[model samples]
Target: MLYLAGLAENSIVDGPGLRFTLFAQGCPHRCPGCQNPETWPFAGGQAAAPEQLVERIAQDPLVRGVTFSGGEPFAQAGEFARLGRLLRARGYEVACYTGYTFEQLFQNGNADQQALLHNLDVLVDGPFVQREQSLELAFRGSRNQRILDVPASLAAGRAVWVRARRWVLDEQPPEA
Candidate 1:
C-alpha cells in the first residue's frame, strides 16, 4: 500500500532532462511554509501499488528518469526502495527529494531509508528554510538545501553537491 500524493508526467524541472515525478504522502517534518501542505498527513493520499506506478512511468518513452518528491519520501522509504530497484532494473535513473539533511538521513534513518538513499542517483536534501527561500536556487526551495550526487557522496562518505549551472542556458544569447 503505497501512499501517493500525485504523479506528474513529462516533468523537466524535477530532474535532469525529462522525468516522471511521484509525490509521496506523509512527512513528519511539517516544515513551515511548505508548498504542498495537503500532503502532510499520512492518510491524506490514495493507496497505489508500486507496479502500477512503475507501469505508468514505463509507458513514457521520452522520460529519462523518475523523481520521487514528497512530503518527505523517507517516511515511505521501504516502499520507495522497492520501487527504485524495480525502476533501476528497467534502466531508469532515480532521484529523490527529502526534508532531512544528508547527515541526518545517514545517521538516523532505518535500514530501508538507508537502502533507498543508496538506490538514488541524485538527492535534493534539507528542509525548506523560509528565510533562505530563493527563486534563483536550482530545483530546491531554499539556499540551505543541496543537490547531491548520491553514489559519489556515498563512496566518499560525505555530501558531494552537484551544481546545476549547465541547465541554465540562455536562449537569446544576449543578441550576439
Candidate 2:
C-alpha cells in the first residue's frame, strides 16, 4: 500500500498536460520553504493499494499523465514502483518529483528505489533549495532541480535532460 498526503485530479501544474498528481506522505528531507510541509510526517495519511489507485486514475479519462510528488515518493519506492508499472502498462505517462538526485538514486538507492526510477518516463530531481528558488522555472521550484529523461539517463548511465518541448525550454539537452 502507498501512503498519500493527498491527490489532485486533472492538475495542470504538476506536469506538461492535465494529470493526476499523487502527493506521497513521508519525507526524509524536509527541505525548508517546501510547498507542502504538512506532508512531512510519515505517520498520518490515507493508505491506498496500487490497484485501487489505478482504478481511481481511470475515472479521469482526460488525464494524459500522472505525476508522483512528495513527501519523497522514494520513501515508499516498492509501492510506487508497482503503481508506476501499472500506469505504464495502461499507456499513461509517468513522472516523479524527487528530492534525491538521479545520480544519488542510480548509485545508492535500494532495489525498490531503482525499480521506481526505471519505471518513470521523466523525473524532476533535487531537493528544494530556498536560496536557489525561482519563480521563472517551468515545472520546478528551484534552479538546482532538473527535468530528466529517465530512459535516456538509464541508457547513458548518467542524468540526461529531457528534450520534450513541453518539458524543457532548450532546443537541445545539455551534456550529461
Candidate 3:
C-alpha cells in the first residue's frame, strides 16, 4: 500500500522541466516551519496500490517526467522504487524530494530507500532549516539542503551536487 497526499498534473517548478508531481504521505522528520504541516502524520492520507499510481503517470502524455515530493518519499521507499523503475523503463526520468540529508540517508535509510535512491534521476535532500531559509535556492527551501544528481551519485558511490539557477526572490519585479 502506498500513502499518497495528492498529485499535481503538471508542474514546472518541482523539477528540471514540466512534470507530474506526486506528494507521498508520512514523514518522521517533522522539521520546524515545514510548508506542508498537514502531511506530517502517516495516517492522514489515502492509501493506494503502486500500479494505480503508475498507471496514472503513464497516461499523462504531456509530462516530461515525474517528481515525487513528500512528507518524505523515502518513508514509502519500496513503492517509490517500484514505480520509479517502471517509469524509467518507459523512458521517464524521476526526481524525488527527501527530508534526510544525503549523509543521513546514506547511513540510515532501509534497503528500500537505498533502492529508490538508486532509481532516481535527481534528489533534493536535507531537512528544512528555517534559520537557513532562502528563497534563492532552486527546488529546496534552505541553504543546507542539496540538489543531487542521483544516478551519478550512485555510480560514484557518493553525492554529486547539481547546479541550479539561483532564484532571487528579492529581485523579481512585482507581479501585476
Candidate 4:
C-alpha cells in the first residue's frame, strides 16, 4: 500500500505517449513554486494498493507507459519499485520524477531507492528552481532538471542524457 497524492490516466504530457501518472503523496523536497504543493504533507492523500494502480494502468491498451511523479516518489521507493516491476512485467515502460540527483541517489539513498532506480527506464531528476523556470523546457519545470536514461547511467557509471529538451514548437502559454 502507498499514499497517493493523485493519479492521471491517459496523460500525454507526463511521458512519451499516453501515460498513467501516479503522484505519490509525500514530499521531503518542498521546492518553492512547486505545482503540487498540496502533496507536501506526507500524511495527506489516500492510501492505495499497488494492485489498484496496476489495474488502472492495464485499463488502456494504447497507453504507452506509467509515470511516477510525486510529492517525491523516492520517499516510498519500495512501493514504487514493486509497482515498477509489475508494470515492466506487463511490457509497460516506467518513468520516475525525483528531486534527488542520480549521484546523490546512488551514493546516499537507501537500498529501496537504489532498487526503484534500477527498475526505471527514465528518470527526471533535480529540484524545481523557480528562478530557472522556463515554459520552453520539455517535461521539466526548470532548467536544472534532467531527463536521464537510467539503465545507461547505471551501466556507464555516469549520467546519460536522453534529450536535452522536448520540442514543443508552436505551443502557446496560457493567458494569465
lDDT of predicted model 1 = 0.83
**Candidate 4 runs further than 4 Å off:** 163-176
In order, the Cα lDDT scores of the candidates are 0.83, 0.93, 0.81, 0.85
For each candidate, give its TM-score against the true structure.
Answer: 0.90, 0.97, 0.88, 0.91
Clashing residue pairs, backbone N/CA/C < 3 A, model 4: none
User: Model 1 residue 108 lDDT?
Assistant: 83
**What does candidate 2 score on TM?**
0.97
Q: What residue runs in model 2 are displaced by over 4 Å at the alpha carbon?
A: 170-173
What does candidate 4's lDDT look like per residue over 1-176, in tens digits?
88998889878777677888999998999999999999999886888888888887787898868999988999999999999988998898899999999989978889999999999989988999999999877678887777787898899887877642342222432221
lDDT of 3 by residue, 72-160 (tens): 89999998899898889888888899998777777787899888987898888889999999887667788777778787777777787
Clashes of 1: 0
Model 3, global lDDT: 0.81
Best by lDDT: 2
| lDDT tens per residue, model 1, 1-176 | 68989988988878778899999998889889899998898987978888888898888798878999998788999999999988988999899999998888887889999999888888888999999998866577887777787888788778886544433231211210
Winner on TM-score between 2 and 3 is 2
Steric collisions counted per model = 0, 0, 0, 0
